[model samples]
Target: MPNETLAGLTILVVEDVTSIRSLVVKLLERLGCEAVCEAADGETAWHHLKRRKFDAVLLDFELQSDDGVSIAWRIRGDDGLINKAVPIVLLTAHDEARIVEAASKAGVDDYLVKPVMPDRLGLRIRAAIDKRQDKLDRQARSTEVSWKA
Candidate 1:
């Protein structure tokens, strides 16, 4: 893949802390991302989504108002509510097995602990986006096959 494949991609950064949010957004920018939207909590993030479409969401695990898992659940539960499908990647300070399990149960596309290196963040973003696209492609193929049947 080209280094700039992420160019023109719009991402939402949902975190309570201003500094961490800025850091993550900057990291995405360095990787050729075109736009970054900010949200301090899940509620605000949901409102932002209502106004604009985002290609992906970098969500913090915990927020003062609402948790990232809840946001991911809402996004995944109503695929038709938005014009475009978004991948949700969780960034947390904790990486316990149970936490990871919970994230998976909530439909998170990817998980990363805080203080992640830039290279690792880029790799994770690519993997999550690619995985989501692959799933979408498979679903399309399956629908086509069924229609012919």
Candidate 2:
């Protein structure tokens, strides 16, 4: 919709709850993602991350077996991941300060509360991607400057 801001972008959605995962997939499709992959748990999500490159990742904060912050940690810390620098958005029902702080330290780009609205979801996704891109651009520029010196 609206020229499809996320058109042709591949994304990963990791959520344990079947209903919530389905809802997120539907929303991503509506947002015009070319390919949206789903993972029910951290293991499945890790499998996808290792094998495929995603433009962004949307993770549920609480899963049946693992938490989203831990997943974010692996994504950021592990050099083996195909998309280690990819933007991550954490979704959660809890609004606790500690949860947000942990996610932030784990390199999560954005956080959203449960029962996400379409507009807010779109905004958050865009913001996360933009923020990550900005960081990458800065890193590239720093490397260029260092080489020039």
Candidate 3:
């Protein structure tokens, strides 16, 4: 990857706690991300998504109004929303197998346990973005190949 691969990427962080929310934002900024949009609850996060676009969403498992699993499900199942394909990374304090399995089933691209390390989170974000971009590139190439064939 380049020195500033995520230079202009935007991240949406949904965490109910003020301190944790700030920490995630700070970490994202340190990783060269351009903007960090924050939401104190899942409801507010949904509102933000409706108004603006984000490259990825980092959601907390437990929110003041709605949980991350529900949020993930809604985003994945809601066909009317344009940001449904946006990669979601669930951040939670639990490391249980059941919770992880549930998150996976809910369409979360990745999960990170609480007290997230800045380096690890950055790596996850990079991998998710690269994977998504690769899929898009492949689809575009296929379309072009079909048109010329």
Ranking by TM-score: 2, 1, 3
Per-residue lDDT tens digits of candidate 1, residues 51-73?
88888888998899888888887
Per-candidate TM equals 0.89, 0.93, 0.86
lDDT string, candidate 2, 1-149, tens digits: 34376778899999999999999888888888899999999999999999999999999999999999999999999987678999999999998999999999999999999998877888899999999999999989888843454
Cα lDDT tens digits for candidate 3, 42-143: 889999888888999999999978899999999989888877888889999999999899998998888899899988898887787777677678878888
Return the candidate ranking by lDDT, descending: 2, 3, 1
Which residue pairs in model 2 clash with each other?
A: none
Relative to the true structure, candidate 2 reaches a TM of 0.93
Off by over 4 Å in 2: 1-3, 146-149
Error of 2 at 73 (Å): 0.4
Looking at model 1, which ten-residue stretch has the lowest summed lDDT? 78-87
User: Judged by lDDT against the true structure, how good is candidate 2?
Assistant: 0.92
Candidate 1 has a TM-score of 0.89
Per-model CA lDDT versus the true structure:
0.83, 0.92, 0.87
Instruction: Give the Å error, residue 110, model 2.
Output: 0.4
**Candidate 2 total steric clashes:** 0
Question: How accurate locally is residue 91 in candidate 1, as Cα lDDT from 0 to 100?
Answer: 95
